[model samples]
Target: MGGDFGPRVTVPAAIDALRRHPSLRILLVGRQEQIDPLLSHCTSIELDRLAVVHADSVVAMDEKPALALRRRKDSSMYLALQAVADGRAHACVSAGNTGALMVLGRGILQTLPGIDRPAITSAVPTVNGHCYMLDLGANVDCTASHLLQFAIMGSVMVRAVENIDRPRVGLLNIGAEEIKGNEQVRLASRLLAEQKQLNYVGFVEGDGVFSGRADLVVCDGFVGNIALKSSEGLARLISRKLRRSFGLNLYRRLLALLARPVLQELQAQLDPGRRNGASLLGLQGIVVKSHGGANRSCFGYALDQAVSEAQMNVPERISEQLELDLQSRDGSVKTF
Candidate 1:
């Protein structure tokens, strides 16, 4: 059990997923008593496709990662990931403590060969469609090397998941000029440029993220997290203003009715629930981290993401790409 609503939300989401994908199976890893009650209404077919693995405890949302790693080995989050590592599950999805999940995921699944650490990446809506951005909250402090690694993984992910032939990679910076960013970004820019494997499109500003100027934007978690949150806040502000403007008077209300179809389509296009899962890339196994406050529909989207990643064998693809890149180089690329 994890997240704000725990099994109450996740159980229904899992049931709904089972309904949608006839071949899908789910392992509900949590306290048996808490999880079982939520499943009482599941159909026989849904019950047949789902199993509950008991977890001794639950990790608190605010628990320190290190402490949870050391003391809460039997927590639901840990057990779910362990299932993946043990080959009992193809992927693990969690809406628990992000820090704890990252720590536990890296420790249990291990990083892919040549990857220093796992970076959190997700698809962000762009003018063209969407692009993946990484280091969302995984590595707040990163070296130039780390940024380069993120770029490689993010590019590979987009190519595999989005089916882009050669995705354009951009380094997030204050300006498009090579001379703008600090030492780390500039160095990372040079590294990315040298890699013929990557389609480096030079520096991208904050606004360039949504402009669809690049297929992937690479940065340390500190910058990426702030940018993501700011974008979310701006979206909420614009939505609120639109609603207020539409209800200002009878004339405005009439206008809103006429514009309802267009507004509905726009809302659907920008729904956060449609893109709920954040992939922890570079891990040896698939692990999708869902937002902790997610409702049933949003959690269902996270489950769908996990299924997609598992089917694509994302970890293996990244590993193969990195190996090819390493051998193609003149002994310059780093591996851990």
Candidate 2:
């Protein structure tokens, strides 16, 4: 009962995930009437692995986060997270109101020890495979401490999920020069460098994000959100131009036909759908936010992200790393 297609897309994606992961179980928390009709075609085995816990309402896409948190306790988004908090579910995945999800997630599941706020982190296609970027519209006005927390959480996440040891961390900035960015970035840079556990490589420019200069890039939500949206728009523009250019004439059409496999591979590599989930890092429980406009396959990827985070015990690992790094600091900055 969230996103553009509601149960129409989510149900099939959930079923497909169940098919792909034999050990997975899904609880469809939504209005039973709307969800039941969509599942009429599910087989008995699929039904056995799936259950529907009726929710009285849903958080609207544009609903105010605070208001929804205060009033819409029975909404599908709220209930889904409640399932995670109650230990009935390992993780919660939603393509609903992002603000509402964050507010309710923090309220119920709570943030990890020593974490002030949860940052939204996701992968973007890079010269390497991809690099994780954080604070993508979670907190627009982040403190230097907040940025440090984001880096720690992102480094932990990359190590756990990507199995990379000593993942390089970079603070997103205007330039590599020491005097390029504002005070927050500069302070965050110094703070990051002091952490011996982090392989901090100093500042990274916007262009460096995809150059594989660093495995994790941290920034305030204002800049990170704009950068992500701009990248997405540019990717769309490039794809459209490619399609139009190849269909211009019979000669180009023949060329496109011959190059279909190559084009398909390129598309697969850059497809945003392949990286649809954005983890709300720093939270005590696993909560993944799917794009509100995501399709069935894209939503399934979000589910996969939640499952992976849960299996890896991301929150515990992050908390442990934070304690180790923050404790080692000589009380100059109060992280905990």
Candidate 3:
């Protein structure tokens, strides 16, 4: 986890994470002063399971990528990445610098065999039910080819997790018109339409993100990042509004007592941390990007989600589907 207040959050998060999941093992990497107390605080059984690497450096959120990596080779984040690459761990979960995570994850795990670029994927619930979005924020400036690759990964996720056959996909564009977008989006539209493996539903607008216009929403990271943040902000605002309504008066307070469970259910639905984090797709191993501000409950949720993703074998499924898509195309790296 990368943050200015590492001990304050990471320590508590790790403790709660262990309490929530009895079988989960954690490898704490940070300065001894920061990591030791947390490890000591864990239950005796959990303490036996907890290990530390005594990493002495850290990369701040604003530190430039090259500068952080060059100056802090033994940083906790770097050591954690090394654990994944060295096969010491099945997956790595972090609430740290995203770009640094992506950079380090790529350096260690590398991209999947057929994927041209790594995409960030997340499960998004629609008005109807749960679905997913790909390239949520990693590649801000995506190419037509990158979007196509994201579609493939998203399809695999839906099938493997939701058991959906030939899941439908939608491109996030200015208009549904075939040629309505900029050069990259326009080109991507054509590519998605031609991909036989995908159930491409054509272009969709931001309004349709959770309206069930499609099972998967694909976009460049810049737009996808904005959409994710907007959804999160709106969810929080709506939750606060509901709470205020319940808190209005004596009668409302009584009503609030009755409505507490309902509100809690709704808040759970909108809880960004409840969903925990987005999976970095098209990588050789699973790397969950938990929110950098995550606390104990949030970290536990992330660990649970990461376990599910690992058990689903997302990396293997992505590789298999991409290879099948590629091999079916006359044995060449042809355009989608």
* Winning model by lDDT: 2
Output the better candidate (1/3) by lDDT: 1
lDDT of 1 by residue, 27-117 (tens): 9999999989898898898899999999999999999999998999889999999999999999999999999999999989999988988
Considering lDDT, where higher is better, how would the candidates rank from best to worst? 2, 1, 3
Q: Model 1: which residue pairs collide?
A: none
TM-score of predicted model 3?
0.85
lDDT of 3 by residue, 146-201 (tens): 89899989888777766788898999998877769899999988888888889999
User: lDDT of candidate 3 vs native?
Assistant: 0.80
**Candidates' C-alpha lDDT:** 0.91, 0.92, 0.80
Cα-based TM-score, every candidate: 0.94, 0.94, 0.85
Which segments of model 2 are wrong by more than 4 Å?
Answer: 330-333
Candidate 1, residue 36: CA error in Å?
1.6
lDDT by residue for model 2 (15-54), tens: 9999998999999999999999989889999999999999
lDDT of 2: 0.92
| lDDT at 183, model 2 | 95
- How far in Å is the alpha carbon of 165 misplaced in model 1? 1.9
TM-score of 1: 0.94
The CA lDDT at 112 in model 1 is 92
